[model samples]
Target: MDMTLLSRLSDFEWRIEAHGKMRVPAILYASEELIRDMDNKVYEQIVNVATLPGIQKAAYAMPDAHWGYGFPIGGVAAFDPQEGGVVSAGGVGFDISCGVRTLLTALKVADVTTVQQPLADALYRHIPAGVGSTGRLNLDDQQLDEMLLNGAQWALKLGYGREADLDRTEERGCMAGARPEAVSEFAKKRQHREMGTLGSGNHYLEVQHVVQIYDEASARAFGLAPDDIVVSIHCGSRGLGHQIGTDFLREMVLQAPQYGIELPDRELACAPIESPLGETYLGAMRAAINCALANRQIITHLVRQAFAEVIPEADLSVLYDVSHNTCKVEEHMVDGHLKRVFIHRKGATRAFGPGHPAIPEALRAIGQPVLIGGTMGTASYILVGTDESERRSFSSSCHGAGRQMSRHQATKRWRGRQLIDELAGRGIIIRSPSSRGVAEEAPGAYKDVTSVVEAAEKAGLSRRVARLEPLICIKG
Candidate 1:
């Protein structure tokens, strides 16, 4: 793919003009080099997204954009129901609400250095991870329904975590309007024993140190300080979310024609929002999102337990927890009027600007923190949404150091033990059940997140707040 074919709209933005059946233009935000490295499939898929029914303004791709099932991994689009808005399972993704949450701890980097190995071992023991891993919870049909219906609140009631923890989470830890009846028996069965497990493939738990603080005031507001140790948990709805996405995608494909919706790609199959098919998918998707929230909430408790065991005096408080996938109904100003729109954000984080009522009160002054998890052995960043981000990209920002190589490609060239030793030489600690996992997540397999963040900031998506490097990581 000749990336130079992408005409620039600005220093950090490019556009693919509406062509053929496209109803809107495609917008991509990334550095010149990043664009060159992107797969031609990404560009082709973004073009397909532009054809989605009732899509508003434009279809936006984050700096992390990469080819995925249908829409690119880092894709966003808003649709208006009054104009035949449609919902696509591809947009919501395989793992609904797969996201990141980081907690600030009183312990410093020096404190962890003393017993890093012990702490890593303790965290690994406490947090269940690996392929097909399950946790302590075993739910029957009735209890699974309750968990799906109530989400994180149900987990809290089960003594997973406290209510105050909800305050620091997006949507207060439970997605409203969730209807478990929309979920299938297969979905419930998949989630029965997977509640607290961090299932494999890119999901992880890392203990890191704040290496730099860019916005002092914002950092203070977020309860972060230089060199302070932090724990980051990243996972999603597990098998349940996947089952929901798959079931709905099949239904949407068969029903799109009934709603008079055309698909440029079968993977982008969708049904009109008013259609029974759309409502069914949305309801079930929201329930899966709630499942993810509960899953993360339970993991939060495990993390708390690990910290209490290793550093009893440390106070671990959540800075923020935000999902990077899922679709939601939101009101945003379009054409000078408030409009209800369905916003699809897959592998992208919501970075609502300052003064937005959606942001937590304490964080409204500094804007929402955009948590960008980096490669397993690399650095992660904390950024604050900008007014430009809200205005230009539907309050969306980059999700991570997007994959630069396919998992197969990564594994073929790199081995697990070598990666472990290499990271340890750089003072990064690691523990994982699968050596193949390490090979698949080699740092060399991802784009330079630092470059991506720079483009995002320059493009006014999100401004940097702080950067963190891993001291310990548990991969699932």
Candidate 2:
């Protein structure tokens, strides 16, 4: 992170002009402090991404950029298929469709304070969490295929959620063009018993209450008010998504040479978008996306049951569900022409602006809700997409307060039990199967979320709407 390595375009924008084998420039959106704190590897990886074939515009990293496989975790890049575009598994990360969904409840902060412990216990009991956790539903091979193809709609058909929930979800509950057949048998087996379970590592279901509202109009559009209770679930495709990334990355690397792809880094292994391998990977990846959508829907059902057990009067409804991983086809204005390109967002969330057809009809005028997750002990924020973001970074925004330290380093610094007790004293209930998991996700392990969001807003990535603080957290 040498300051001289990049040209400062503005207070929140830095640029690396095209050099060496780079096909386009590399842009990073962050404040001067955030840029100075970023690992040098982020600069290396993002520059490498610019060398990929058919890449459109420039390779961009969000304010929360951090070192990661191939592309930086907060990387964003678009590629054109007609111009020999390539798809990289590493750019999408192992956790495909890893996202967050916030559920609004009828109760207020006062209502939850009375039975917070019971509610936490009920959620921990009802929702399976931690590594290798399995859920109540065990899908057979046939059922698994059906679930992969149908996504959350399949869960609704099975009485897991309501029809209205799909309206607030990305892809309207099911992703199109999911070829379940492309998913390997082993991958299917790994997911068979994982549906509805929250896998370990930075995943959780938290009960939060709004503490502040930044944009009154947007907050009202999102049905938010002071002290309103909301449950936010953060998880993803579990083993199935990891298996897909593993299966495809290996193939992509081995076949890169055959396709005349000279990868600057093996982790950036990719194939021509028109290649058979590319098509197969897309099929499998889309299926994993569906798997994640279905998984969240089922978890929502479990959360509802947990709430009913603790507070029967509570009514939970989907506010918004958005994924931060995977590659997607989107239309963008490049060089004054509207063109279709495949946009890869690793640890970045899509913040489609208002008036986009893809947004839910009711919320379209306001814009997509961009949910930014914070550590269990910190505060999360709700932001709305801005039209400026579409032009600035392809409608991409920071996913979270990017990790500044590794899990191992976090454990060394703090004991999980002690951290839990400390968080508990702050009126935040912590429930987890493993104390070590809690330690690994210590609030100190991540960059200041407030700073990250502020940088994103300054960069015109999104507009903050509301801030939420944790009341109860069920960690994986």
Candidate 3:
């Protein structure tokens, strides 16, 4: 984290020139304070990433970068398959397709306040949460495979959600190329009862209200106004995704030598993109992505039901849904030529700029909606991708206020019951199965979200749209 260790390119850009076995430079986008606060392991991991086979451009880290398994948590990199590119399981974290989705509600802040406690209790009762939580649906082997292959579309067929919701979702709620058979039987079993449940560790469903609008034009495009109520769901594929990552990471490590991959670190184990192992992993990974999308869609349906019980007239509509962790095939301009590449985004959100065909047609002029989640007590922000971001960092941005402390450290520093009481005093209701879970996610345990978002905007990664504050949180 030493300032002198990197070459300063600008206020928000720092670079480590390619050297030794490195194929390209490693770039970090952050303010001076944020860069100094980053752990040294982030620098080492990114440098390690630069040495990987077929890596393109550079290995970049966002403002919220943190040390992770192989690549840094807020890392971004692309690879070319024709150039012997590799697909790494470690590049995608255990919580595959972990992401956030926001729902626009007809009610405003004042309406929510009238039944805040009732609504909170209803959501807590309706939405299954906590470790090993089970939802109402229990799929058999055949049904599980269908869910894995079809994602939210499967849920919609079962009367969980409407068709319109797919238009606002990434990949239209079902990721293609998902080979359910590639997923292990044990992984499918683990997800059977966890379809609509919010798994433990940093996952939550919150009722939030917009408090500030940063860009009027973008805010209008996203259908946001001051004091409007919104619900945000943050989670992933649950046990299925974790098991897939575990299964593949172990296999990748054992098979790397056979593929002629000289791993800089055992955790960076990978197989060549064209290899059978790599293709199989991608198939299963894509299935997990669908699992996450289906899970979120089901949760949205549950949220609607909860609202109907408390405020019958309230209408909840999908604002946008986006995933953070995955290796996606995308086309990018490389050396003045448009080339296809695999983009790995770990703990980073895809922020496709305006006019990109990938973005939903309705929101294309403004850009993709980048949802940035905050802690239970802090404020979350909505940002839009910028054209400059595509050139700067592959149209990627920070996912959240990166953790500055471990869960153990957070538990030791704060008591959950007391913290919940404190949050309640500030008009935020907290509901969870475990008090320890609440303590583990103490707001002070993370970096200043406002500072992170400001750095991201200044770095041209994304532009802030609106700010949201939590009114009720159902944590896991």
Candidate 4:
């Protein structure tokens, strides 16, 4: 990485030649400081991704790129099966479809403060959070399988939330290709009790107030009003996704060579798209996605119920739900040909710009809503996909203000109680089942989100529409 190997494409873009074992070059979008701050291993990971079978164009990294297991965390790669593509479990990460979802409430911030303490208490009492937290609703094996297959739709049928909520969600609240039977028993056991729960480490349920409006017209289109209190949940498929990633990495490593696949890096071990092992992993991964979607749906209902007990006027409606990790078959124009390819997004959100068929009819004109959750003590933003994004990237954007420090470093620098008091003095209420968890996600531990958003806008990945500040945060 230190060699004068990278060619500057623009002030915001850089290209690294794919010399050895690489089928294509690696493209990275970032500023000078952001790129220099990136770990050198990210360059190697991106090169490894470039060597992927049937890979199209080049492996690309978002402005928030960082070193990760296989592909850089903020990475995007596409494989054309027609050209003999392969799927890597590492590309999907442990938290399949781990993403952010925000809801717009009818009430304003002024209304929330009337019973803020009670509202927080009720949410804390009802919504399961923290490590190993379990929901009150227990499911038998058969019921769990049903939920895995049907996703949030299953939760809605069981009285968790309203049907209208699905409209704004990606894939209409359910990943279409889920196969519950393909999921392992161990994975099922771990996730059975975790449904509707927010697991620890950068996960939370927060009530925010829209503090700034960037695109006045788009904000109105998305039903976001300035100073409007909203709920944002950040979590994922939990143990089930972790278990699937673990199970497949072993299988893929063992069978990769058998499928005539060579590993540029062991962590990038993958299976041919046509192989049975690849199909099995996809099925189970999709099932885990369902668990995540259903999990958020159930939590939304719990949060709504909690509000009813206090404010009663808080009408929370779904804005959008999108995941940052996953590998899905998508149709993209590669080299002037319309082709079906498997696109892998790790720690990156899909920004389906305006007029794309995948977006819901209601939001098609305004494009997809991209929710970028900030550090616990910072501000989150809502952005819209621009048509230019699909052309510049593979419709990919940064997921958050990428971590600037490790959790251990963050916890070591900031103490829980003191951090809580500091935030409260700024009019931000912080509540958690664990304060240590609070310190681990200190806002200063991450890069400036405003800068990250600016980078995304400049890269044509996504354009900012509104900024949301946390009023009340419940950490897990």
lDDT of each: 0.90, 0.95, 0.95, 0.88
Model 3 Cα lDDT, one tens digit per residue, 243-272: 999999999999999998998899998888
* lDDT for model 4: 0.88
lDDT at residue 319 of model 2 (Cα atoms): 98
TM-score of each: 0.98, 0.99, 0.99, 0.98
Model 3 regions more than 4 Å off: none
Q: Per-residue lDDT of 284-346 in model 2, one digit per residue for the tens?
A: 999999999999999999999999999999999999999999799999999999999999999
Q: Which model is ahead, 1 or 2, in terms of lDDT?
A: 2
Task: Say which candidate scores most in lDDT.
Answer: 2
Q: What is the lDDT of residue 306 in candidate 3?
A: 98
TM-score of 4: 0.98
Q: In model 3, how many backbone clashes occur?
A: 0
Residues 48-73, model 4: lDDT tens digits: 89988899988999988888998899
Candidate 4 wrongly placed segments (more than 4 Å)? 1-3
Error of 3 at 80 (Å): 0.4
* Order of the predicted models by lDDT, top scorer first: 2, 3, 1, 4
